[model samples]
Target: EPEVTQTPSHQVTQMGQEVILRCVPISNHLYFYWYRQILGQKVEFLVSFYNNEISEKSEIFDDQFSVERPDGSNFTLKIRSTKLEDSAMYFCASRSQTSSYEQYFGPGTRLTVT
Candidate 1:
């Protein structure tokens, strides 16, 4: 089965810098999402996308954050300005139209903001 893939397994950046995390979800999936886990915290939803538009977003997904499918295969999350609190393991997930409850997750990108 196909799986989600993410780039730059780990990233380190200074506070106030910009960072872009990339992913490639299962090609056949219709829904895409971005989630983050702050250290020992539970996973938190950031945003969801479908058909080239944002379907829903959490409060954490403020103006500083954005997501887009720049091409047929690549999905990206850009943080305009990083904050110390933004350090976490960021995951990219996707599920088919028929399975809304199950998501295939990528190997997360670990972001460290100092």
Candidate 2:
């Protein structure tokens, strides 16, 4: 079975540096999304993309964040000028819209900003 996969499962970076987290979801899935969970906080949606354009985005997706599906295979989230508050677990998910909205999630990338 195809499952979502993420790279650099653990990341340690400086507060002002850039971070690129990568993910590859199921091959036939169409919708992709990014969400984050702070240490002990609830998961929050960041953005969603389909057909090479963003379909939805939360206020958290400000000028510092971006999402890309550059090659039709891998999806990525880039954070510029990371912040201590940005330290959290980032998840990449995907699923087809044809049925229920159930989502398949990646193992997640834990980002630690120091």
Candidate 3:
């Protein structure tokens, strides 16, 4: 079965630097989303994209963040200016249909901003 994949697994970065987290969503899936969990916090939705435009985004998705489908299989999230609070496990997910809300998550790219 096809599965979502994330790069680096873990990263440590200085505050105010740029970081790009990479993901490869499940093949043939359409709806893509990014969520983050800050240590003991709940998984918070960041953004969801489909048909090449953002479908929905939470308040947490500020100007510092952007996402893209760089190619057929690769999806990317870029943080233009990282902050210490940005430390979290960023998960990439995808679903085949809108009616099916179950999201298959990647192992995650842990961003540690210090």
Better of 1 and 2 by lDDT: 1
Displacement of the residue 22 alpha carbon in candidate 3, Å: 0.5
Per-residue C-alpha lDDT of model 2 across residues 1-114, encoded as one tens digit per residue: 789999989999999999999999888899999999998899999999999999999999999999899997999999989999999999999988685878999999999999
Point out the worst 10-residue segment of candidate 3 by lDDT: 94-103
Clashes of each: 0, 0, 0
TM-score of each: 0.96, 0.96, 0.95
Compared with the true structure, the alpha-carbon lDDT of candidate 1 equals: 0.97
- Give the per-residue lDDT of model 3 (tens digit) for 1-114: 789999979999999999999999988899999999999999999999998889999999999999999889988999999999999999999998854667899999999999
Question: Local error of candidate 1 at 65, Å?
Answer: 0.1
Q: Tell me, by lDDT, which candidate is best.
A: 1
lDDT accuracy of residue 99 in candidate 3: 43
- Every model's Cα RMSD, please? 1.0, 0.9, 1.3
Q: Give the Cα-based TM-score of candidate 3 against the true structure.
A: 0.95
For candidate 2, the 10 contiguous residues with the lowest summed lDDT are: 95-104
lDDT for each residue of candidate 1 in 1-114, tens digit (9 for 90 to 100): 789999989999999999999999999898999999999999999999999999999999999999999999999999999999999999999989987669999999999999
